[model samples]
Target: MREKLGKISNFLVSLAAGIASFVFTLVAVLVVTDFNEKLAASLIMGLFALLIVWVASEQPNSSQARAVSALIKRLLAVGSGDLTSPTPAAVRREMPALAAAVDNLFEQVRSNLDNVHAIALYDPVTSLPNRVHFKREADRVLKARGWDDGVALLFIDLDGFKEVNDSLGHAQGDQVLTMVANRLRIVVKAETREDSLAPPLLARLAGDEFTLLFPRVREPAEAERIAQSALVALCEPFEVGEQTIDMGASIGVALSPRHGTDLAALMKAADIAMYHAKESGRSQASMFHARMAAAFEEKVQTEKALREALGRSEFELAYQPQLDARSGVVVAGEALIRWNHPYDGLRLPDSFIGIAEESSLIVDIGDWVIDGVAATAARWHARGMAQRLTFNVSPKQIERADFFDRLRAAVERHQAPLRMLELEITETLVMKCGDRVIAELAALRAEGLSIAIDDFGSGYSNLARLKDMPLDRVKLDRSLTADVDRSEGALAIVTAVIHLIHGVGCEVVGEGVERREQLDLLRAVGCDVVQGFAFSEALAETEFLDWVRDNAPLRLLPRSA
Candidate 1:
């Protein structure tokens, strides 16, 4: 188009020059003939110059207009289709600078558009396909697969993620999520290579929620293996900034055309499976089964029943005496919690404590236990049956912002002597958050309450840690007592543990002492206290009161001399 305009402009200038030359020749001839004729020639030359300017500006050939129309059509085609057209040589030469600039602009626009599209389809944070793109790809893959073949959708939800955010802050939480995403990517990539079929697609659905679509999975086991790998990957500690956080994930997997034939169904099934994974225990993976759905429905009913039970105050405490091994005297009684669900009857910790822990009902439940046990102990103290009352403390409860304040209030409310209260914490709990546990224990001990380590040697049993921690006593794990008859190693370990704990000026209590030999070995090993079926099981509140009254001086060996 510009080339045509240039040609017309040149022709106009040439024509004007020819006309001016002719007029100049005439003026020269007139000048020679008569000097007065020069003015007329000048007037004619000016008229030709004006005509040249007008014609040069006009599109006389209509070629420039036609070329412009063609150029616009080409540009529209490039916009609609692939933009691979080359600029014409004529256009380039006629408008060299403008043509070059336009070409560069088009290329830049194309590059930017590509980037925008890529980001829209994939998350920049994880580099995984976003939900929008994953759904599209999953549908395509499922539709193409034969009925005999199967696809699996694994939904992964991280456990305790909120704790990471709460304790470490959101920046560290994001770092952990990024690390999880990277691990998932590696696992999915590996699976894709193994199958050699339609490779699986992994995506981040939202915060701490990710999805993996395995195409053409050979069998249910393939999906199971993938889920297991994901669980293992997530179980490893995440190194975030200066701290290492133990972040774990639960995965639920559902197979297409089996669990669900459509996206919504598949998603629902996967969600249900994920819930099961969390309910069964965090840091595990579960596959969708018909029974799991049934169990989930039952769990929903159980949760409702539990909440109702709580409102009705149907929960109670059972006391088991912690006997001084040498004298057989009940120096303290450990408070064992029981849920007297109206419908479910008496329930033990094994049945419901897990549910409480997962739902964070442990804090409320733990408080109830503390208050009820403290009140019972206070009553006993008023009746001249005063003995230390021990209650278990969950890690979740200890980590609460108001743990110490709430505990202090509970003791004051019950008017229970702080010296007669003992808090039993598991070794695993202590090791999980050592500094926090130590500080909390020190505070509680300073308040005149005793602290005992429960299930000692069940976790990182560092002797130095035990010596440094603010603990008054340690409870030997039941495993050690159970194996005392079968393994000399077990007996030696118990003996060493007792000596070590005593060396640190802390008392040792033996748990699960069911047989005479076990009790004898524990006493011989210098255990200060013993509690198990060997004496009696946990008793009802009234039965415990009577037993405490009747068994006044509980003697272990009847003062053998």
Candidate 2:
């Protein structure tokens, strides 16, 4: 095109010059020759001078037109995807100035296209692949035998996201989400192998929801390991702005061709596994299993029933007397929780304590135990029975923020003296969060309530910790006391524990003292209290009160050695 235009322009210029030269020559000839010689001679000299000047000026125009034509050709070639064109040396001086601008324009166009595509395929906030693009790519890969060997899909949902959002506001919640997304990305990238047929893809499906697709997993174990890694990654605290928030994710895993063959089925299986993870306990990962579905459903029903049980007041307390070893008199009674399930008859703590602990319903159950025991103690005081009342406290109850306040209210409501109430905590509870538990125990002690370390020797028993704790008594665990007479080792340990506890200014209570030899051993060891079937099993409130009345210490003579 540039060549054709150049030809047309040159021809027009040549024609104009040719016409002028011809006219000038004709006039020169007419003057120089016999026909008007003076006029012709003057015209010929003027024409020759003009021709020289015109030729010199016209040469630059032709050269300029040729340069422009070459430049136009180079530009057209570049635009048409023919980058092999050698830059015309003749036009380099001028064209080089425009070359960089053209190159930059092309670069800008490419960059803009890349940005547009990125926005379409990724979540703006997290920069994780969005569901739309993930599904599209996954489907393409699946169709092309991308997952022929093995692939695992994990669907992760944040367990306590709603609680965080509700307590901290949406801004903090969003920051947490972003942190979680970053963590997921790092975990997936680290676990995925570079040489694998297909690498893992991480996507944020929606609010507090993320998905990971691990293509070309070496084995099922590999998928499980990756899921576990994801769980561990989420275990750390997320620093969002100034606040440090902790959140956990429940991951559900489904392996392709095993759990399902397609995206929808695999996602469903993963969802089921996720529900199982939540049901078993949040903050864990679970693989798809058919049995887990039924178990998950049962847990839902059980939670609902428990909530209903609370509302219907289908709970009661049973009393177990702690006997003074010397006089065989009841020194105190321990209150035991029993759930009077309407259909299941009566259920013990072993059946419901776990459920209660998980759902935080133990707080209410703990409150009920306190109130009932306080009322029992008040009744005994009114009847002139000067004995203390003891109730067991689980770690959950002791850790509750309102524990002390609730206990105070129960004591006040029933007019029970703090000195006559004892709180029994397990050794494990005290050791789990040692400093805080010790401080809380001290506070309770200062309020005039007695504290006993229950189930001693079963947990991580640090003698130093026990001595430092504000405990009034120590109850030897049943395992140590059960075969005291038969096992010399058991007898020695029991004797040592009793002497040690007494030396620390704390009384010793021997639990599960069923046999005569056990009671005799406990007595010899100087145990202050003995509680078990040796006297009577944990009894109903009425049976206990009746036994208390019949076995009044005043009626029994002191035993002689």
Candidate 2 per-residue lDDT over residues 357-448, each given as its tens digit = 77778787788888898898888778877788888987788777778778888889999888888999888766655465577779879988
TM-score of each: 0.71, 0.60
Pick the lDDT winner: 1
Q: What root-mean-square deviation over C-alphas does model 2 reach?
A: 12.9
| Clash pairs (backbone) in predicted model 1 | 327-555, 328-554, 328-555, 328-556, 329-554
List where candidate 1 sits over 4 angstroms from the true fold.
1-124, 127-149, 157-173, 190-199, 225-251, 268-286, 434-437, 555-561
lDDT of 1 by residue, 424-444 (tens): 887877665646657877987
The superposed Cα distance between candidate 1 and the true structure at residue 257, in angstroms, equals 1.3
Clashes of each: 5, 2
Q: In candidate 2, which residue ranges exceed 4 Å CA deviation?
A: 1-198, 201-213, 216-288, 432-440, 552-561
